[model samples]
Target: MLLITGITGHTGGYFLKELINNKYEGAIRCIVRNTSNTSSIDNSRLNIEKVVGDLDDPEFINRIMVGVHTVMHIYNIHHSPMIVQAAIENKINRAILVHTTGIYSKFKYASEGYKIIEGKISELIKNPKCPTSITILRPTMIYGDLCDRNMSKFIKMVDKLRIMPVINGGRSLIQPVNARDLGVALFTVLMSQKETTGKVYDLSGEKPIKMIDVFKIITKELNLKTIYISVPLSIGVSLARILKILTLGKIDSIERVQRMGEDRSYSHNNATIDFGYNPMSFEKGIKIEVQEYLKKNRN
Candidate 1:
């Protein structure tokens, strides 16, 4: 049996669909919270099952791990240790975790949290007491459809304002991977679990582009006239900090602004060498996402 966490999320949803379309022979189980809307994934497949519960609950973890062999954790990285503990207890052999490249960011808080989780996972994987093999994939900014919280927001902003702000001339480099491509990469890793165990790979787009260029590509795709205003990084960070305080952290803060100003590009060569992880170009990915966003909003 195969166990999947966060099956209803963007990347997870794509992973689930790919699995089903490939006619996976094993039974699939999904753990979801009570408030999670499964309407989109409420399929009639006999092999698919949904269990409602919080990941924080030990009882829930115990119940969900029964008869499950391989686990794909696509949700919160914070809950990974708990999941690994439960998987070890249940004698599950292999596990894959979806993490982010933000762990390597210059921002202290962002890097610290991911670093803690990554360290915990590494420690557990190395422990002889736990024999479950682990594979960790750290992907760069993921953007696709309306569900994405990253570039989709920028697309909407450009569509509305027709003018966007560029911090430090938006020179900071970013390699945004498509969610579907990420799903494929995860599947590839799962199929080659033995070779990928106890390894970490950085997944990214085909190439890195300047932040300002990303905005220009979006505007060009939409055939919209948008002007970019270059703002000093220091001033932008200060304004974001003030807004963050005023909005009670609802808006971008100092750390977020700092991360935006730092380069986030990474080479996916290791992933490719390990599992043939070839992702599409950002231009093509953004074009597909923009089309989806337009179609979704048109309804």
Candidate 2:
């Protein structure tokens, strides 16, 4: 049986779909806190057993991991090392950890923003009780269904402002991987237990697109007559800082704007080679996202 946590989330939902699509002959159990909410899947092969408990609860881990072969951990909350550690303690042989790429390059940013995600991962990996072979997949900006935030916000902002701002020298790059592709990569990793144990895969899109160009595409898709204005990074940072202070730094929107002005490009050659990861093109991903947005907002 395959046990999945955070089944309501983007990658988790997609992973469930991928599993069903592949016709895996196994019981799929979703450990969800809210048993009242049923998944949108209509497949007989999918059996969701909602284990009602929080990740912070110690006793819930053992109860959920019982008789589970593989555990796909996709918790939205960053901390809570106990969740994974408990799985390890329960002797789940194969575990797949879904981490964000933000954890590597800027460790400080990752640690502060992510809050013990990578640290917890390392802790679980080194623990003696952790006999479970683990595969870590860190992805960059993800876009597609179940994504009500991030890129969708950009599109909404453009639709609202009727004009988009592109930071000066908007050549900073981004690789927004489609959610389905990420799901596919996760299933591929789980299905194959070869040389991936104790390794990390950077699952990114096929190509990186300029941040400004991304806004342009979003604007065009919304059929909005918008003008792109380039703002200096210094000014943008100051504004972001002020807004952050104003918002008390709770999910600051300005911080996201500041990041767009900075370059964030990397090679996913390792993931491609290791897991046969084939992420969809950024263009196609954006197109699908746009369609989904339009459909959601349609009258």
For 38-142, candidate 1 gives per-residue lDDT tens digits of 875677353788898898888888889999999999988898988888888889998899988989987778888989988887777777878688888898999
Error of 2 at 107 (Å): 7.6
Overall lDDT per candidate, in order of appearance: 0.87, 0.74
> Per-residue CA lDDT of candidate 2, range 39-76, in tens?
45444356656666777767877788889988888766
The CA lDDT at 69 in model 2 is 88
User: Which TM-score value belongs to model 2?
Assistant: 0.89
Error of 2 at 271 (Å): 1.9
Best by lDDT: 1
Candidate 1 local lDDT, residue 262: 91
